[model samples]
Target: MKRIAILGSSGGNLYNLGGKEPLKLLGEIETQASSAGIKIAAIQFIGAKASMDNANESTLSRLYTWNSSEENIVFSEEKALKEVNGEAKKVDSIIAKMIEDGKVQGLVLMSSDPEGVNNLSIKAAAKKDIPIVGTGGTSMATIQSMGGKVIATSGTTGTTNRTRAVAAIQSLSRHWGLKYKPVISSSGKSSQNLDENIFQRISFRGIMMAAIPGFIAMSIVLALSKIPGLAKLNDAFDLLIKGLPVVVAAIAANQVSGLDEVGIVAGVVAGMLSIDGGLIGGLIGGILAGILAFYLIQLALRWNFPGTTANIVAGGLSGLISGLIVFFLISPIALSLGNGIRYIIELALNYNSIVAGAIAGLLIWPAIIGGVYHAAILPIVLLEMEKTGASFLGAIDMTGLVMVSAGITLANIIYPKQKSESAIAVPGFLINIAFGTFVEASYPFMFSDRLIFIGAILSAALSGVFVGIFNVKGTAYVPSVTAPALSNNALGFTISMIIALVSSFLITLFANKISRNKRNKEA
Candidate 1:
């Protein structure tokens, strides 16, 4: 176990900044580290009282209460006071004492004012070559300035506590997994946090890529063995048999890792049934659920439903309906359809090489990666790939889809009001429809200003055209937006996507500037 010195804020100058924040940060860090198998030999709370006392009385009282209650932290006032003065030698002496006793391994300086007491501690620690971990007291900009690792989590004030908890857990898991469990210290726990919607797009992309392929394979083997020559094709048979299990296992792992039960179910179903009913079922179900929730809430509101209550009810209902539709209606239909979608994909694969290639791309890259990211579109890609065998056409489709989605998402955020029901909404519906249909949910933001968004989409469409013309194909999906890393004709996909991204950015910016100027002139 490494020893950690938790230096609290000093008095007067910068006490107000991290007086209480240090406590919170320390508590979180310690708890997380401990959970990850780290051992804390000792904790020194330097100048916690003086630092907090110098702040508002209320803040001081809170610190006093917290320190007195925690059994792990040993309150030390002398080192803190000495560090505040130019007598840092005295502080170092204490640290030396702890080190000589083999009780101290590293230092955790929690000061909002890094220039004050923190600077002294940092200097001393640097001289000793001791590792330091910063928390709320340090700025994101300055935490790394001292060459120490600083972990940060984001959330609103209301959600900070919850965010902190999750952050603590994640940090702990990472530390434990990496075999760095040594010593940990922490501040008290709090619960304020933000919603998880911030990561939806990233989540969406991962799930679709893996689960979809598994679903397709499952559907074929389980329900549709009747197709002519299916058994005779060794590669196809191998993929249908072997690929299905691997995809499913990966999806299960993904579900457990993210701790998302809903995502797990949706992902599994999506991957298991992309053809006869799964792919269309998910899309149709999602759309219908959205529409039904929208209408039902509207109707309920007319009868005087409370706004908050109505929103919760509608959202849950929508999600529920979507899930039910996918599981019940889609899965069975997909199973019974006897490789119908695969048959179509096979026909394309046999006849048009490009189409076959594109289908192949959808199966390998997008489906698996999407499952990892989104998990919902897993079935479609998996089904397509097993049938197509990594065709060029598939690569084109995957790249085109991702680019458009990215553009639309970017655009929507930038021009949120412009596309809203009220005035000032910037074309969200139009952009969303365009990209969402072809790509995932990441494309709309390309032109946030207007010109850039339009330009990007146009470039993307052009890229798609190029794909069609060149017959560039791959056996795997476009794993990421980067073209160089693409499976086949990687350079081509990379070039096309980049062009789309840049063009969209320019067009959207120009359009937005012109629109703003015209409005200014009118006024």
Candidate 2:
């Protein structure tokens, strides 16, 4: 059979080898198995005391060389031990004896330690033309430099590559009869971001420039949260809902001028109408307005209302009723939380943006599926004010109004095309509802038709730009459709939301048409 030998040099004293170190021995054994067509006959020398359970021993084990039957296998010397060249020579001598005994076919080295036992082992292995397999601590970088076969453990420091490698190997093992296991390891995280301290050191300008820190943050969350607890919380749907109201409201409010006022009034009224809302007027407004809009649209559609007619009725009626409640009831609560935008901003700045983003992404998908509009994102934002101060809510409110304005504008562009024909489930209506209730619902539709979603993202980003540029602020805990009433340059937020909505809706319609055309052609 294929017979190859590995000389393993570890940091631990050469006394007792068992458990994890055996696995390294097993690794070489398997390599030998591939070289020859037989099972491993002997394991002559392994780091006896290399405790995989302990760091010191493990470190020592990885840094020395051992030999079996004239084959010298090397493990890299730890940088800390580089000064101890004499002690390293003793380990190399032990490796040479095993090789001379003809116990193995070829020698394998685990790493390159220039001045220690590992270096000597390499020299010995080369003299005999023994195939040497070597790897380093940084497998990707070191393997490339050394031009040797490299295998690293999953969840290691270089997590992305390690994950990719594990996935590839697992897939290969499943499809073929190959079994590949990792030799290095860390806690089972697929990826990690910069340390907290490093992240904290970034300039405010850098944070702003990295505008979509959400992008990187979301990706990291996706990677790490593979397990149940972390995954569910870090889910994209959850992130989407966190800031959905501010985002959607900012887009929808501008569809019709009165709507923003109506939204604000609704917020105020909802706050006063219910004891809970009165306690947190802005958040209550977002929820009530969402619920009101949802029921109104459903009722109008059920009554055989025309599309355009239904939208106008739904938008006006919902906004007006909600506004009245908010103006009288919620206004008092908002007065205490913050007199104006300044209060909301100062109080709410401490809310976790990453968590908010994750919640928003997570909720977007389900909301779309469930036909809930953009209301899902409101609560998280409303709560954010409590975390930051009270002024954060005001900012959230202004943002929401801007989003609504954008949504309305988008609806106007797309609705006209599909107005005459009824769809089983209207795309914009579905997206709106999903955003309000189950934000995750947005993903399916977006993924199903990427062409449409890309347009939506671009529009939304443009709207976000306006938000950034205009520095719009509101006076409530959550967004109000009436942001135009509160801010100086709210028109930009309104216009951008319109752009996003129109783009989203139109793309959906276009995608649907294209899909239908292709299906018909195929049929």
Candidate 3:
């Protein structure tokens, strides 16, 4: 079971701001958590004495009751000074210990007072890579600013604390693969804004969420099929690989549809019909179908149609409309687009592999930092993989993106500007080399110093030249250590990674030396 700790001030804010009884809100959270297979391992209350004294009597009584009766709930109370400056330290220490003991996997934060619960606990959790779900304006904004594996249940402003709390549980439940109906307020309204932009509704994070499961399934099946006893599973592996588009479409549509069942049905139908257009068509069709179904369901509801009737109308109309549109209008266009891009890339490779590789390597870091890599480059890479089962661009990603990150982070460990910097660098380097997926591990160092960033991109370009000259191409988004074996030219891939690592490392060392000298001069 997943374990979590709830940390925040008392319940006075909930009742005051949202007109919600604290006990009732907690009950809703408990029900959602139970459905999601999550356990509330601990709850630590932190607030100034005045706030604690002002807390709802029913809420305090229930907390005492839970502490008295529940074996699973570890409860603690920390009373801070009236100024609230030291409110989070005691709670942070408790959480840090719990994290060290592996008793906590996630955090739930609720605090309306910005000054009461500072970044102490947040930094503690972020350092250990624990996911945090925050409710209340101050808590949500703090988590978002820190930017590591955090979820804000509502926008930082304009939402009631109770709404955020309810939404937080729902988000957590959905994240853990459970279907919990959204909590509707007594006013017959939903927390979600129906008029939110379509583009904003289509989440890149959700798209990645769609891609990861299929990728993992294919990876596991492919690996297992190589065993002698599992040779028959090769057909199953192939089927999974070929059906990737459908899986991506279904999940993407579900996310775009706000997890509506009707939207998911529409997505599946659209995905099936758009199979001829490959992953791009499926993705586009799924998003379109979800949008159509979402609005249709809302319209039906507005007209006061019966729930079942609304679902049937939305699902039937969306499925038919999206499927036909994809098949007749979108498929041919998507196919042609994919083919044309593939042809241009192939031409570049033929004309001068080194130049193509260098250009791609040099530009990739900018794309990623600018947050355009997913929308601009990922589709091209996916299309390349669908058609050829291998991609030169994928090779560049492994060397330029993944290996370069390992190098930059490792340099920070070896030549850190401070001991604290080195302490963080150690985990970043290990995570980069071991998992090879989290390029953001190097962000601390990259964002701190411009020299390091420049060195990284230059080293990546050089490494790309190595791969291009040796014609190395293979799978992407795997550990760099294993990437060589998967490549067409293992020796070439290995050399490319080495070039990326060593060049960036040496450049970082030089950059650090210059920075220290400048600091000394200023002093």
C-alpha TM-score for every candidate: 0.31, 0.25, 0.61
For residue 31, what is the lDDT in candidate 1? 60
lDDT of 2 by residue, 1-523 (tens): 3344443333222122212354434443443233223333333233424332354422443333334454344455443333334455666665555455554444433323434444444444445444443323432243334443222212121112222222223322323344433222222221222111222322322222222222223323433455456657444634543333233232222211112233333333333333332224433344455446445544554454433344444455665565456557665765465334434433433354333322333333344346442233333333333222222223333233223323433443444224332341345344443332222324444555666555445444444444444443333212234334333344753553454455555656666677667877998
RMSD of 3: 17.0
Model 1: per-residue lDDT, tens digit, 1-523? Answer: 4445555443333344333454554565456455444545434333444544353432322221123244454432333343334333344455546655556555544343345434554455555655544334333235457654443322112122212333333433443353432122224422211122212323334434545545434433432333465554545555555345324432432232231222333333333333234333444343334344434444443344433334344445544655566566665664444268656645665576454443343343334334442343334445454434343434444445555444444544464325451222234333433332334343334324445444544555565555544555442232343223323455665665555445544455455557667877998
TM-score of 3: 0.61
Using TM-score, rank the candidates from best to worst.
Answer: 3, 1, 2
Report the C-alpha displacement of residue 156, candidate 1, in angstroms. 42
Q: Report every candidate's CA lDDT.
A: 0.42, 0.38, 0.66
Candidate 3 lDDT by residue in tens digits, 1-523? 7777776654344444332334434444454455456776665544333344365322322221124245333323432243233434555566567776778777776553333443555565667787777655545675666764664343323233333444565556656665544332322224443336455778755685458546645655655666689898878877875687676677667677653456677788878887877777788878887787767765654454434455665666776688778889998897788789899989999999999999989998998899877776766666666654556877887788888888888888888877688888888788778866678888888889999999989998999899889987755566777767656677998999899999989998898889888988999
- Give residue 300's error in model 3 in angstroms: 3.8
RMSD of each: 19.7, 25.0, 17.0
Which model scores highest in lDDT?
A: 3
Which 10 successive residues of model 3 have the least lDDT summed?
57-66
Of models 1 and 2, which has the larger lDDT? Answer: 1
